[model samples]
Target chain A: MSDQPTGVPREEYRPSPSDIAPKLADLQVGRTVVTASIPLSRADLVRYAGASGDYNHIHWNERFAREVGLENVITHGMLTMGSVISRIAEWAVDPGAIVDYRTRFTSPVVVPDAESGAPDTPTTSLEMTASVGAVDTEAGIARLDVEVTSGGTKVLGRTQVKVRLS
Target chain B: MAVNTELQGSSYPLAQPFEVTREAIAQFARATGANSRSHFDPESAAQFGYSDVVAPPTFAVIPAQRTEALYITRPDAGIDFARVVHGSEQFTYTRPIVAGDVLAATCHVDGIREAGGHAMITTRTELTTADGDEPVATVVSTIVVRGEDA
Candidate 1:
Protein backbone atom coordinates (compact mmCIF):
# COMPACT_ATOMS: atom_id res chain seq x y z
CA MET A 1 0.00 0.00 0.00
CA SER A 2 1.07 3.56 -0.69
CA ASP A 3 2.27 5.39 2.42
CA GLN A 4 1.00 8.68 1.08
CA PRO A 5 -0.56 10.71 3.83
CA THR A 6 -4.32 10.98 3.87
CA GLY A 7 -6.18 14.32 3.77
CA VAL A 8 -3.19 16.13 2.31
CA PRO A 9 -2.93 17.41 -1.24
CA ARG A 10 -0.84 15.09 -3.42
CA GLU A 11 1.33 17.90 -4.73
CA GLU A 12 2.95 18.16 -1.33
CA TYR A 13 4.41 14.70 -1.87
CA ARG A 14 5.34 15.04 -5.51
CA PRO A 15 8.50 13.43 -6.89
CA SER A 16 10.59 15.43 -9.32
CA PRO A 17 10.54 14.18 -12.89
CA SER A 18 14.28 13.60 -12.82
CA ASP A 19 13.80 11.20 -9.96
CA ILE A 20 11.12 9.10 -11.60
CA ALA A 21 11.30 9.20 -15.42
CA PRO A 22 13.14 6.30 -16.98
CA LYS A 23 15.92 7.03 -19.43
CA LEU A 24 15.19 5.95 -22.98
CA ALA A 25 18.81 5.03 -23.58
CA ASP A 26 18.61 2.43 -20.82
CA LEU A 27 15.39 0.83 -21.98
CA GLN A 28 15.55 -2.59 -23.64
CA VAL A 29 12.84 -4.33 -25.58
CA GLY A 30 11.15 -7.27 -23.83
CA ARG A 31 12.23 -6.17 -20.38
CA THR A 32 9.62 -6.35 -17.66
CA VAL A 33 9.51 -2.97 -15.97
CA VAL A 34 6.37 -2.60 -13.91
CA THR A 35 4.50 -4.94 -11.58
CA ALA A 36 1.77 -4.09 -9.10
CA SER A 37 -1.27 -5.39 -7.30
CA ILE A 38 -4.20 -3.00 -7.03
CA PRO A 39 -6.89 -3.73 -4.47
CA LEU A 40 -10.55 -2.93 -4.98
CA SER A 41 -13.43 -2.74 -2.56
CA ARG A 42 -17.15 -1.99 -2.79
CA ALA A 43 -16.57 1.58 -1.66
CA ASP A 44 -14.24 2.11 -4.61
CA LEU A 45 -17.03 1.19 -7.03
CA VAL A 46 -19.36 3.80 -5.53
CA ARG A 47 -16.64 6.44 -5.59
CA TYR A 48 -15.80 5.69 -9.23
CA ALA A 49 -19.47 5.86 -10.22
CA GLY A 50 -19.78 9.31 -8.68
CA ALA A 51 -16.57 10.56 -10.25
CA SER A 52 -17.10 9.24 -13.78
CA GLY A 53 -20.85 9.99 -13.89
CA ASP A 54 -21.45 6.33 -14.80
CA TYR A 55 -24.18 5.57 -12.31
CA ASN A 56 -24.80 2.05 -13.57
CA HIS A 57 -26.45 0.16 -10.74
CA ILE A 58 -24.68 -3.04 -11.78
CA HIS A 59 -21.52 -1.54 -10.42
CA TRP A 60 -22.89 -0.80 -6.96
CA ASN A 61 -26.13 -2.66 -6.26
CA GLU A 62 -25.98 -6.42 -5.79
CA ARG A 63 -29.64 -6.90 -6.63
CA PHE A 64 -29.35 -5.00 -9.86
CA ALA A 65 -26.21 -6.93 -10.72
CA ARG A 66 -28.00 -10.22 -10.23
CA GLU A 67 -30.93 -9.07 -12.30
CA VAL A 68 -28.48 -8.32 -15.09
CA GLY A 69 -27.06 -11.89 -14.92
CA LEU A 70 -23.84 -10.91 -13.18
CA GLU A 71 -22.43 -13.07 -10.44
CA ASN A 72 -22.13 -10.04 -8.21
CA VAL A 73 -21.33 -6.36 -8.34
CA ILE A 74 -18.50 -5.70 -10.80
CA THR A 75 -15.91 -2.99 -11.24
CA HIS A 76 -16.44 -0.57 -14.07
CA GLY A 77 -14.21 -1.37 -17.04
CA MET A 78 -13.09 2.23 -17.30
CA LEU A 79 -12.31 2.32 -13.61
CA THR A 80 -10.00 -0.64 -13.96
CA MET A 81 -8.48 0.84 -17.10
CA GLY A 82 -8.00 4.22 -15.50
CA SER A 83 -6.49 2.88 -12.31
CA VAL A 84 -3.75 0.76 -13.93
CA ILE A 85 -2.37 3.55 -16.10
CA SER A 86 -1.32 5.56 -13.08
CA ARG A 87 1.50 3.09 -12.57
CA ILE A 88 2.58 3.64 -16.16
CA ALA A 89 2.44 7.41 -15.66
CA GLU A 90 4.74 7.01 -12.71
CA TRP A 91 7.14 4.89 -14.75
CA ALA A 92 7.21 7.45 -17.54
CA VAL A 93 7.37 10.23 -14.97
CA ASP A 94 4.85 12.36 -16.84
CA PRO A 95 1.20 11.64 -17.40
CA GLY A 96 1.32 13.69 -20.59
CA ALA A 97 3.96 11.46 -22.08
CA ILE A 98 1.43 8.80 -22.93
CA VAL A 99 0.03 9.25 -26.42
CA ASP A 100 -1.88 6.05 -27.09
CA TYR A 101 -3.50 3.29 -25.06
CA ARG A 102 -5.76 0.43 -26.03
CA THR A 103 -7.24 -2.66 -24.48
CA ARG A 104 -9.79 -5.42 -25.04
CA PHE A 105 -12.01 -6.31 -22.12
CA THR A 106 -12.14 -10.08 -22.17
CA SER A 107 -13.60 -10.75 -18.76
CA PRO A 108 -15.46 -8.93 -16.02
CA VAL A 109 -13.88 -8.23 -12.67
CA VAL A 110 -16.43 -9.51 -10.21
CA VAL A 111 -15.85 -7.72 -6.90
CA PRO A 112 -17.52 -9.73 -4.18
CA ASP A 113 -19.25 -8.07 -1.29
CA ALA A 114 -17.62 -7.85 2.07
CA GLU A 115 -17.83 -10.91 4.24
CA SER A 116 -20.10 -10.92 7.25
CA GLY A 117 -17.16 -10.54 9.61
CA ALA A 118 -14.97 -8.01 7.78
CA PRO A 119 -16.85 -5.05 6.36
CA ASP A 120 -13.88 -2.96 5.26
CA THR A 121 -11.64 -5.53 3.64
CA PRO A 122 -10.92 -5.46 -0.05
CA THR A 123 -12.70 -8.14 -2.04
CA THR A 124 -10.05 -8.72 -4.70
CA SER A 125 -7.03 -7.29 -6.45
CA LEU A 126 -5.82 -6.84 -10.01
CA GLU A 127 -2.42 -8.33 -10.63
CA MET A 128 -0.53 -6.54 -13.37
CA THR A 129 2.74 -6.97 -15.26
CA ALA A 130 4.03 -4.65 -17.98
CA SER A 131 6.98 -5.05 -20.31
CA VAL A 132 8.60 -3.11 -23.06
CA GLY A 133 7.33 -4.51 -26.34
CA ALA A 134 9.08 -2.18 -28.73
CA VAL A 135 11.30 0.90 -28.73
CA ASP A 136 11.56 3.50 -31.45
CA THR A 137 14.73 5.46 -30.96
CA GLU A 138 14.23 7.80 -33.90
CA ALA A 139 10.65 8.59 -32.96
CA GLY A 140 11.51 8.76 -29.28
CA ILE A 141 8.65 6.43 -28.44
CA ALA A 142 8.30 3.18 -26.53
CA ARG A 143 5.47 0.69 -26.54
CA LEU A 144 4.55 -1.44 -23.55
CA ASP A 145 2.48 -4.60 -23.48
CA VAL A 146 0.56 -4.80 -20.25
CA GLU A 147 -1.14 -7.91 -18.91
CA VAL A 148 -3.79 -7.42 -16.24
CA THR A 149 -5.47 -10.33 -14.53
CA SER A 150 -7.92 -10.88 -11.72
CA GLY A 151 -8.23 -14.20 -9.89
CA GLY A 152 -5.81 -15.77 -12.39
CA THR A 153 -7.98 -14.89 -15.39
CA LYS A 154 -7.10 -12.24 -17.93
CA VAL A 155 -9.44 -9.26 -17.79
CA LEU A 156 -7.77 -7.00 -20.35
CA GLY A 157 -6.25 -8.40 -23.53
CA ARG A 158 -3.81 -7.09 -26.08
CA THR A 159 -3.28 -4.10 -23.82
CA GLN A 160 -0.76 -1.67 -25.20
CA VAL A 161 0.51 1.75 -24.14
CA LYS A 162 2.67 4.12 -26.16
CA VAL A 163 4.77 6.76 -24.46
CA ARG A 164 6.86 9.59 -25.86
CA LEU A 165 10.29 9.94 -24.35
CA SER A 166 11.71 13.34 -23.47
CA MET B 1 -34.05 -6.56 -29.50
CA ALA B 2 -31.21 -5.87 -31.87
CA VAL B 3 -29.62 -2.43 -32.21
CA ASN B 4 -30.72 -0.41 -35.20
CA THR B 5 -28.34 -1.19 -38.02
CA GLU B 6 -29.40 1.96 -39.85
CA LEU B 7 -27.60 4.11 -37.31
CA GLN B 8 -24.30 2.98 -38.66
CA GLY B 9 -22.18 5.81 -40.05
CA SER B 10 -24.38 8.37 -38.27
CA SER B 11 -22.81 11.09 -36.14
CA TYR B 12 -24.20 12.74 -33.00
CA PRO B 13 -22.71 15.94 -31.68
CA LEU B 14 -22.97 16.76 -28.02
CA ALA B 15 -25.59 19.38 -27.25
CA GLN B 16 -23.65 21.04 -24.44
CA PRO B 17 -20.04 21.98 -23.91
CA PHE B 18 -18.03 20.08 -21.34
CA GLU B 19 -16.11 22.53 -19.21
CA VAL B 20 -13.20 20.79 -17.61
CA THR B 21 -12.54 21.91 -14.06
CA ARG B 22 -9.84 21.40 -11.47
CA GLU B 23 -12.26 19.90 -8.98
CA ALA B 24 -13.45 17.32 -11.44
CA ILE B 25 -9.91 16.37 -12.36
CA ALA B 26 -8.98 16.05 -8.70
CA GLN B 27 -11.99 13.91 -8.00
CA PHE B 28 -11.27 11.58 -10.90
CA ALA B 29 -7.64 11.31 -9.90
CA ARG B 30 -8.57 10.41 -6.36
CA ALA B 31 -11.12 7.85 -7.44
CA THR B 32 -8.61 6.16 -9.74
CA GLY B 33 -5.84 6.36 -7.16
CA ALA B 34 -3.73 8.58 -9.40
CA ASN B 35 -1.46 10.53 -7.09
CA SER B 36 0.32 12.59 -9.71
CA ARG B 37 0.77 16.21 -8.68
CA SER B 38 -0.02 17.48 -12.15
CA HIS B 39 -3.53 16.11 -11.76
CA PHE B 40 -4.14 17.95 -8.50
CA ASP B 41 -2.08 21.16 -8.31
CA PRO B 42 -2.20 23.95 -10.85
CA GLU B 43 1.27 25.07 -9.89
CA SER B 44 2.70 21.65 -10.60
CA ALA B 45 0.86 21.46 -13.87
CA ALA B 46 2.18 24.85 -14.92
CA GLN B 47 5.68 23.65 -14.22
CA PHE B 48 4.97 20.74 -16.51
CA GLY B 49 3.96 23.15 -19.33
CA TYR B 50 0.21 22.81 -18.93
CA SER B 51 -2.15 25.71 -18.47
CA ASP B 52 -3.87 24.17 -15.47
CA VAL B 53 -4.22 20.92 -13.62
CA VAL B 54 -3.69 18.03 -16.01
CA ALA B 55 -6.31 15.32 -16.33
CA PRO B 56 -5.49 11.66 -16.57
CA PRO B 57 -5.62 10.21 -20.09
CA THR B 58 -8.76 8.20 -19.49
CA PHE B 59 -10.72 11.28 -18.43
CA ALA B 60 -11.75 11.76 -22.04
CA VAL B 61 -14.18 8.86 -21.63
CA ILE B 62 -16.43 11.00 -19.47
CA PRO B 63 -17.27 13.35 -22.31
CA ALA B 64 -17.09 10.61 -24.91
CA GLN B 65 -19.74 8.60 -23.10
CA ARG B 66 -21.99 11.64 -22.91
CA THR B 67 -21.68 12.06 -26.65
CA GLU B 68 -22.54 8.39 -27.17
CA ALA B 69 -25.65 8.80 -25.05
CA LEU B 70 -27.22 10.73 -27.88
CA TYR B 71 -27.35 7.50 -29.85
CA ILE B 72 -27.66 4.97 -27.03
CA THR B 73 -30.78 6.60 -25.62
CA ARG B 74 -32.63 6.81 -28.90
CA PRO B 75 -35.64 4.48 -29.09
CA ASP B 76 -34.54 3.19 -32.45
CA ALA B 77 -31.11 2.27 -31.12
CA GLY B 78 -32.66 -0.76 -29.37
CA ILE B 79 -30.06 -0.80 -26.64
CA ASP B 80 -31.02 -2.05 -23.20
CA PHE B 81 -28.52 -0.37 -20.91
CA ALA B 82 -28.66 -3.13 -18.34
CA ARG B 83 -27.57 -5.74 -20.86
CA VAL B 84 -24.73 -3.77 -22.41
CA VAL B 85 -21.15 -4.77 -21.68
CA HIS B 86 -18.02 -2.90 -22.49
CA GLY B 87 -15.96 -4.81 -25.06
CA SER B 88 -12.95 -2.69 -25.91
CA GLU B 89 -11.54 0.83 -25.82
CA GLN B 90 -8.79 2.71 -27.59
CA PHE B 91 -7.59 6.29 -27.17
CA THR B 92 -5.12 8.37 -29.13
CA TYR B 93 -4.35 11.78 -27.67
CA THR B 94 -2.79 14.82 -29.28
CA ARG B 95 -2.10 16.14 -25.84
CA PRO B 96 -3.16 15.56 -22.28
CA ILE B 97 -6.41 17.24 -21.29
CA VAL B 98 -6.05 20.05 -18.77
CA ALA B 99 -8.37 21.94 -16.49
CA GLY B 100 -9.87 25.11 -17.99
CA ASP B 101 -10.34 23.49 -21.39
CA VAL B 102 -13.86 23.77 -22.78
CA LEU B 103 -14.45 20.68 -24.85
CA ALA B 104 -17.09 19.07 -27.07
CA ALA B 105 -17.41 15.64 -28.61
CA THR B 106 -19.10 14.19 -31.66
CA CYS B 107 -19.77 10.48 -31.63
CA HIS B 108 -19.83 8.53 -34.86
CA VAL B 109 -21.40 5.12 -35.06
CA ASP B 110 -18.85 3.25 -37.10
CA GLY B 111 -20.56 -0.12 -37.29
CA ILE B 112 -23.24 -2.36 -35.81
CA ARG B 113 -23.57 -6.07 -36.42
CA GLU B 114 -24.97 -9.22 -34.87
CA ALA B 115 -22.55 -11.99 -33.99
CA GLY B 116 -22.91 -15.11 -31.89
CA GLY B 117 -26.14 -13.99 -30.19
CA HIS B 118 -24.88 -10.49 -29.40
CA ALA B 119 -25.04 -7.06 -31.00
CA MET B 120 -21.64 -5.43 -31.37
CA ILE B 121 -21.60 -1.69 -31.76
CA THR B 122 -18.53 0.41 -32.43
CA THR B 123 -18.37 4.16 -31.85
CA ARG B 124 -15.69 6.75 -32.43
CA THR B 125 -15.78 10.04 -30.58
CA GLU B 126 -13.68 13.04 -31.50
CA LEU B 127 -13.01 15.49 -28.68
CA THR B 128 -11.96 19.03 -29.51
CA THR B 129 -11.71 22.43 -27.94
CA ALA B 130 -15.05 24.20 -27.88
CA ASP B 131 -13.53 27.52 -28.93
CA GLY B 132 -10.63 26.83 -31.31
CA ASP B 133 -11.71 23.37 -32.48
CA GLU B 134 -8.25 22.02 -31.70
CA PRO B 135 -8.21 18.28 -31.70
CA VAL B 136 -7.55 16.80 -28.29
CA ALA B 137 -8.28 13.13 -28.55
CA THR B 138 -10.08 10.39 -30.40
CA VAL B 139 -11.83 7.64 -28.47
CA VAL B 140 -13.01 4.40 -30.06
CA SER B 141 -15.21 2.07 -28.08
CA THR B 142 -17.00 -1.23 -28.66
CA ILE B 143 -19.95 -2.43 -26.63
CA VAL B 144 -21.66 -5.81 -26.71
CA VAL B 145 -25.38 -6.19 -26.05
CA ARG B 146 -26.30 -9.75 -25.16
CA GLY B 147 -29.25 -11.40 -26.89
CA GLU B 148 -32.28 -12.14 -24.71
CA ASP B 149 -32.17 -15.83 -25.34
CA ALA B 150 -28.48 -16.01 -24.64
Candidate 2:
Protein backbone atom coordinates (compact mmCIF):
# COMPACT_ATOMS: atom_id res chain seq x y z
CA MET A 1 0.00 0.00 0.00
CA SER A 2 0.99 3.63 -0.48
CA ASP A 3 2.84 5.24 2.45
CA GLN A 4 1.34 8.64 1.75
CA PRO A 5 -1.15 8.80 4.56
CA THR A 6 0.63 12.14 5.13
CA GLY A 7 1.53 12.83 1.49
CA VAL A 8 5.27 11.90 1.80
CA PRO A 9 7.13 10.25 -1.06
CA ARG A 10 7.93 6.54 -0.89
CA GLU A 11 11.67 7.24 -1.30
CA GLU A 12 11.51 9.13 2.03
CA TYR A 13 10.44 5.98 3.83
CA ARG A 14 13.87 4.30 4.12
CA PRO A 15 16.92 6.47 4.58
CA SER A 16 20.43 5.06 4.63
CA PRO A 17 23.12 6.45 6.92
CA SER A 18 25.60 6.89 4.09
CA ASP A 19 23.11 9.33 2.57
CA ILE A 20 23.69 11.80 5.44
CA ALA A 21 26.85 10.67 7.27
CA PRO A 22 29.12 12.74 5.06
CA LYS A 23 27.29 15.92 5.99
CA LEU A 24 27.16 14.89 9.63
CA ALA A 25 30.94 15.01 9.79
CA ASP A 26 30.75 18.75 8.98
CA LEU A 27 28.31 19.34 11.89
CA GLN A 28 25.20 19.72 9.81
CA VAL A 29 22.72 20.71 12.49
CA GLY A 30 18.99 20.92 11.69
CA ARG A 31 19.40 18.67 8.69
CA THR A 32 16.72 16.13 8.04
CA VAL A 33 18.59 12.82 7.98
CA VAL A 34 16.06 10.02 8.01
CA THR A 35 12.39 9.18 7.56
CA ALA A 36 10.49 5.92 7.98
CA SER A 37 6.93 4.70 8.21
CA ILE A 38 6.02 1.99 10.70
CA PRO A 39 2.86 0.07 9.85
CA LEU A 40 1.04 -1.59 12.71
CA SER A 41 -1.97 -3.86 13.02
CA ARG A 42 -3.76 -5.68 15.85
CA ALA A 43 -1.87 -8.86 14.98
CA ASP A 44 1.38 -6.95 15.13
CA LEU A 45 0.50 -5.67 18.59
CA VAL A 46 -0.33 -9.19 19.69
CA ARG A 47 3.08 -10.33 18.49
CA TYR A 48 4.66 -7.44 20.36
CA ALA A 49 2.77 -8.37 23.49
CA GLY A 50 4.23 -11.85 23.31
CA ALA A 51 7.72 -10.59 22.60
CA SER A 52 7.72 -7.80 25.19
CA GLY A 53 5.66 -9.55 27.85
CA ASP A 54 3.43 -6.51 28.18
CA TYR A 55 -0.05 -7.92 28.56
CA ASN A 56 -1.68 -4.53 29.00
CA HIS A 57 -5.36 -4.71 28.15
CA ILE A 58 -5.40 -1.40 26.35
CA HIS A 59 -2.99 -2.76 23.81
CA TRP A 60 -5.17 -5.68 22.72
CA ASN A 61 -8.52 -6.05 24.40
CA GLU A 62 -10.85 -3.65 22.59
CA ARG A 63 -13.68 -4.04 25.04
CA PHE A 64 -11.42 -3.43 28.01
CA ALA A 65 -9.76 -0.45 26.37
CA ARG A 66 -13.11 1.22 25.71
CA GLU A 67 -14.33 0.40 29.15
CA VAL A 68 -11.40 2.39 30.54
CA GLY A 69 -12.31 5.44 28.38
CA LEU A 70 -9.91 4.76 25.50
CA GLU A 71 -11.69 4.93 22.13
CA ASN A 72 -10.48 1.48 21.12
CA VAL A 73 -7.53 -0.88 21.40
CA ILE A 74 -4.45 1.32 21.53
CA THR A 75 -0.87 0.50 20.68
CA HIS A 76 1.55 0.13 23.56
CA GLY A 77 3.52 3.27 24.02
CA MET A 78 6.69 1.22 24.46
CA LEU A 79 6.01 -0.81 21.34
CA THR A 80 5.74 2.35 19.28
CA MET A 81 8.83 3.72 20.97
CA GLY A 82 10.67 0.47 20.36
CA SER A 83 9.57 -0.02 16.77
CA VAL A 84 10.55 3.46 15.67
CA ILE A 85 14.07 3.08 17.04
CA SER A 86 14.69 0.37 14.45
CA ARG A 87 15.11 3.05 11.82
CA ILE A 88 17.73 4.77 13.92
CA ALA A 89 19.45 1.49 14.52
CA GLU A 90 19.37 0.68 10.84
CA TRP A 91 20.84 4.06 10.05
CA ALA A 92 23.72 3.36 12.36
CA VAL A 93 24.36 0.12 10.41
CA ASP A 94 25.07 -1.27 13.84
CA PRO A 95 22.35 -1.64 16.43
CA GLY A 96 24.96 -1.33 19.17
CA ALA A 97 25.88 2.21 18.14
CA ILE A 98 22.82 3.72 19.80
CA VAL A 99 23.85 4.68 23.33
CA ASP A 100 20.89 6.65 24.55
CA TYR A 101 17.24 7.07 23.56
CA ARG A 102 14.24 8.74 25.16
CA THR A 103 10.71 9.87 24.39
CA ARG A 104 7.61 11.34 26.02
CA PHE A 105 4.23 9.94 24.97
CA THR A 106 2.20 13.04 24.21
CA SER A 107 -0.88 11.39 22.68
CA PRO A 108 -2.49 8.05 22.03
CA VAL A 109 -2.42 6.23 18.65
CA VAL A 110 -5.81 4.62 18.52
CA VAL A 111 -5.84 1.33 16.56
CA PRO A 112 -9.27 0.93 15.04
CA ASP A 113 -10.78 -2.51 14.57
CA ALA A 114 -10.71 -3.84 11.00
CA GLU A 115 -14.49 -3.72 11.06
CA SER A 116 -14.33 0.05 11.54
CA GLY A 117 -14.35 1.06 7.87
CA ALA A 118 -13.26 3.99 5.72
CA PRO A 119 -11.94 7.03 7.62
CA ASP A 120 -11.10 4.91 10.64
CA THR A 121 -8.95 2.20 9.11
CA PRO A 122 -7.56 -0.57 11.30
CA THR A 123 -4.12 -0.69 9.70
CA THR A 124 -2.55 2.60 10.74
CA SER A 125 1.05 3.67 10.36
CA LEU A 126 3.43 5.93 12.27
CA GLU A 127 5.56 8.45 10.43
CA MET A 128 9.01 9.00 11.89
CA THR A 129 11.44 11.72 10.89
CA ALA A 130 14.81 12.43 12.43
CA SER A 131 16.97 15.53 12.24
CA VAL A 132 20.53 16.25 13.25
CA GLY A 133 20.05 18.21 16.45
CA ALA A 134 23.61 18.23 17.76
CA VAL A 135 26.98 16.69 17.05
CA ASP A 136 30.05 16.38 19.25
CA THR A 137 32.99 15.47 17.03
CA GLU A 138 35.35 14.87 19.92
CA ALA A 139 32.99 12.43 21.59
CA GLY A 140 31.84 10.93 18.29
CA ILE A 141 28.29 11.42 19.55
CA ALA A 142 25.41 12.73 17.50
CA ARG A 143 22.06 13.73 18.95
CA LEU A 144 18.92 13.22 16.87
CA ASP A 145 15.58 14.93 17.37
CA VAL A 146 12.91 12.48 16.28
CA GLU A 147 9.25 13.17 15.57
CA VAL A 148 6.64 10.40 15.53
CA THR A 149 3.16 11.04 14.17
CA SER A 150 0.20 8.71 13.66
CA GLY A 151 -3.00 9.65 11.94
CA GLY A 152 -1.67 13.20 11.50
CA THR A 153 -1.21 13.65 15.25
CA LYS A 154 2.12 13.91 17.02
CA VAL A 155 2.14 11.03 19.45
CA LEU A 156 5.61 11.46 20.92
CA GLY A 157 7.22 14.63 22.28
CA ARG A 158 10.84 15.53 22.85
CA THR A 159 11.83 12.27 21.22
CA GLN A 160 15.59 12.07 20.95
CA VAL A 161 18.32 9.52 20.47
CA LYS A 162 22.08 9.85 20.96
CA VAL A 163 24.39 7.69 18.89
CA ARG A 164 28.07 6.95 19.19
CA LEU A 165 29.44 6.76 15.67
CA SER A 166 33.12 6.59 15.09
CA MET B 1 -8.53 5.61 42.67
CA ALA B 2 -5.82 8.24 43.02
CA VAL B 3 -2.29 6.92 43.32
CA ASN B 4 -0.74 7.24 46.77
CA THR B 5 1.96 9.85 46.72
CA GLU B 6 3.69 8.32 49.71
CA LEU B 7 5.31 5.62 47.57
CA GLN B 8 7.91 8.02 46.26
CA GLY B 9 11.49 6.94 46.91
CA SER B 10 10.39 3.35 47.30
CA SER B 11 12.86 0.85 45.87
CA TYR B 12 12.06 -2.70 44.92
CA PRO B 13 14.89 -5.21 45.18
CA LEU B 14 16.04 -7.30 42.24
CA ALA B 15 13.98 -10.33 41.45
CA GLN B 16 14.96 -13.53 39.65
CA PRO B 17 17.59 -13.34 36.98
CA PHE B 18 16.48 -12.74 33.37
CA GLU B 19 18.21 -14.75 30.70
CA VAL B 20 18.59 -13.23 27.25
CA THR B 21 18.12 -15.89 24.61
CA ARG B 22 18.63 -15.79 20.88
CA GLU B 23 15.04 -16.87 20.37
CA ALA B 24 13.69 -13.99 22.43
CA ILE B 25 15.88 -11.46 20.62
CA ALA B 26 14.80 -12.80 17.24
CA GLN B 27 11.16 -12.70 18.26
CA PHE B 28 11.47 -9.11 19.42
CA ALA B 29 13.24 -8.15 16.23
CA ARG B 30 10.51 -9.66 14.11
CA ALA B 31 7.73 -8.11 16.18
CA THR B 32 9.29 -4.65 16.07
CA GLY B 33 10.26 -4.93 12.41
CA ALA B 34 13.94 -4.54 13.28
CA ASN B 35 15.62 -6.11 10.27
CA SER B 36 19.20 -5.88 11.53
CA ARG B 37 21.03 -9.17 11.34
CA SER B 38 22.66 -8.56 14.71
CA HIS B 39 19.30 -9.23 16.29
CA PHE B 40 18.86 -12.60 14.66
CA ASP B 41 22.03 -14.10 13.25
CA PRO B 42 24.76 -15.10 15.65
CA GLU B 43 27.42 -14.96 12.95
CA SER B 44 26.46 -11.45 11.85
CA ALA B 45 26.34 -10.32 15.47
CA ALA B 46 29.88 -11.51 16.04
CA GLN B 47 30.97 -9.45 13.04
CA PHE B 48 29.68 -6.43 14.92
CA GLY B 49 31.75 -7.40 17.99
CA TYR B 50 28.88 -9.02 19.84
CA SER B 51 29.39 -12.58 21.06
CA ASP B 52 25.86 -13.50 20.01
CA VAL B 53 22.75 -11.98 18.56
CA VAL B 54 22.37 -8.50 20.05
CA ALA B 55 18.95 -7.44 21.18
CA PRO B 56 17.21 -4.40 19.72
CA PRO B 57 17.85 -1.22 21.68
CA THR B 58 14.43 -1.10 23.31
CA PHE B 59 14.39 -4.74 24.32
CA ALA B 60 15.45 -3.73 27.80
CA VAL B 61 11.92 -2.52 28.48
CA ILE B 62 10.69 -6.09 28.66
CA PRO B 63 12.66 -7.04 31.75
CA ALA B 64 12.60 -3.56 33.26
CA GLN B 65 8.84 -3.20 33.07
CA ARG B 66 8.41 -6.65 34.52
CA THR B 67 10.43 -5.53 37.52
CA GLU B 68 8.63 -2.18 37.85
CA ALA B 69 5.28 -3.92 38.08
CA LEU B 70 6.35 -5.40 41.38
CA TYR B 71 5.42 -2.14 43.03
CA ILE B 72 2.74 -0.89 40.63
CA THR B 73 0.68 -4.00 41.23
CA ARG B 74 0.75 -3.89 44.96
CA PRO B 75 -2.75 -3.31 46.35
CA ASP B 76 -1.52 -0.73 48.84
CA ALA B 77 0.37 1.26 46.21
CA GLY B 78 -2.99 2.68 45.03
CA ILE B 79 -1.93 2.48 41.36
CA ASP B 80 -4.94 1.79 39.17
CA PHE B 81 -3.94 -0.16 36.09
CA ALA B 82 -7.16 0.80 34.34
CA ARG B 83 -6.37 4.49 34.55
CA VAL B 84 -2.65 4.51 33.90
CA VAL B 85 -1.09 5.96 30.75
CA HIS B 86 2.56 5.68 29.90
CA GLY B 87 4.05 9.18 29.89
CA SER B 88 7.71 8.70 28.99
CA GLU B 89 10.61 6.26 28.69
CA GLN B 90 14.39 6.67 28.63
CA PHE B 91 17.25 4.23 28.43
CA THR B 92 21.03 4.36 28.87
CA TYR B 93 22.99 1.27 28.02
CA THR B 94 26.52 0.43 29.02
CA ARG B 95 26.67 -2.34 26.46
CA PRO B 96 24.44 -4.29 24.11
CA ILE B 97 22.52 -7.11 25.69
CA VAL B 98 23.56 -10.23 23.82
CA ALA B 99 22.22 -13.72 23.88
CA GLY B 100 23.40 -15.94 26.77
CA ASP B 101 23.74 -13.01 29.17
CA VAL B 102 21.66 -13.05 32.32
CA LEU B 103 20.52 -9.84 33.95
CA ALA B 104 18.87 -8.74 37.20
CA ALA B 105 16.88 -5.54 37.54
CA THR B 106 16.26 -3.32 40.56
CA CYS B 107 13.37 -0.87 40.40
CA HIS B 108 13.40 2.47 42.20
CA VAL B 109 10.59 4.96 42.46
CA ASP B 110 12.50 8.11 41.67
CA GLY B 111 9.62 10.58 41.69
CA ILE B 112 5.89 10.77 42.33
CA ARG B 113 3.84 13.90 42.18
CA GLU B 114 0.42 15.31 41.34
CA ALA B 115 -0.27 17.43 38.26
CA GLY B 116 -3.53 18.69 36.82
CA GLY B 117 -5.42 16.43 39.19
CA HIS B 118 -3.45 13.41 37.97
CA ALA B 119 -0.68 11.37 39.50
CA MET B 120 2.67 10.92 37.78
CA ILE B 121 5.09 8.28 38.92
CA THR B 122 8.64 7.94 37.65
CA THR B 123 10.56 4.70 38.01
CA ARG B 124 14.16 3.82 37.31
CA THR B 125 15.23 0.24 36.71
CA GLU B 126 18.91 -0.56 36.93
CA LEU B 127 19.94 -3.74 35.15
CA THR B 128 23.10 -5.62 36.04
CA THR B 129 24.72 -8.89 35.13
CA ALA B 130 23.62 -11.70 37.38
CA ASP B 131 27.05 -13.23 37.71
CA GLY B 132 29.27 -10.25 38.59
CA ASP B 133 26.97 -7.31 39.33
CA GLU B 134 28.31 -5.50 36.27
CA PRO B 135 25.89 -2.78 35.21
CA VAL B 136 24.07 -3.42 31.95
CA ALA B 137 21.46 -0.71 31.42
CA THR B 138 19.27 1.84 33.17
CA VAL B 139 15.62 2.30 32.14
CA VAL B 140 13.54 5.20 33.38
CA SER B 141 9.80 5.20 32.85
CA THR B 142 7.09 7.68 33.79
CA ILE B 143 3.40 6.76 33.99
CA VAL B 144 0.42 9.00 34.65
CA VAL B 145 -2.68 7.93 36.52
CA ARG B 146 -5.69 9.93 35.45
CA GLY B 147 -8.17 11.11 38.01
CA GLU B 148 -11.87 10.32 37.73
CA ASP B 149 -12.67 13.58 36.02
CA ALA B 150 -9.94 13.16 33.45
Candidate topping lDDT: 1
**For residues B111-150, could you state the per-residue lDDT of candidate 1 as single tens digits?**
9999888999999999999964699999999999999887
Tens-digit per-residue lDDT, A102-163, candidate 1: 99999999988888545435778888999999988898899999999999999999999999
> How large is the i-RMS for each model, in angstroms?
2.2, 4.9
| lDDT of each residue in A17-133, candidate 2, tens digit only | 343433348658898877988777677778789999999889989899989988899999988998789878877777888899999999998877666544323388899999999
- Candidate 1, CAPRI quality class derived from DockQ: medium
Error of 1 at A5 (Å): 12
Tens-place lDDT per residue, model 2, B7-59, is 89999866688899999998888777777767877878877778998899999
Quote the chain B TM-score of every prediction.
0.97, 0.96
Please tell me what DockQ candidate 2 reaches: 0.46
Q: Give the per-residue Cα lDDT of candidate 2 at A110.
A: 85
User: Any idea what lDDT model 1 has?
Assistant: 0.87
Lowest lDDT block of 10, candidate 2 chain A: A6-15
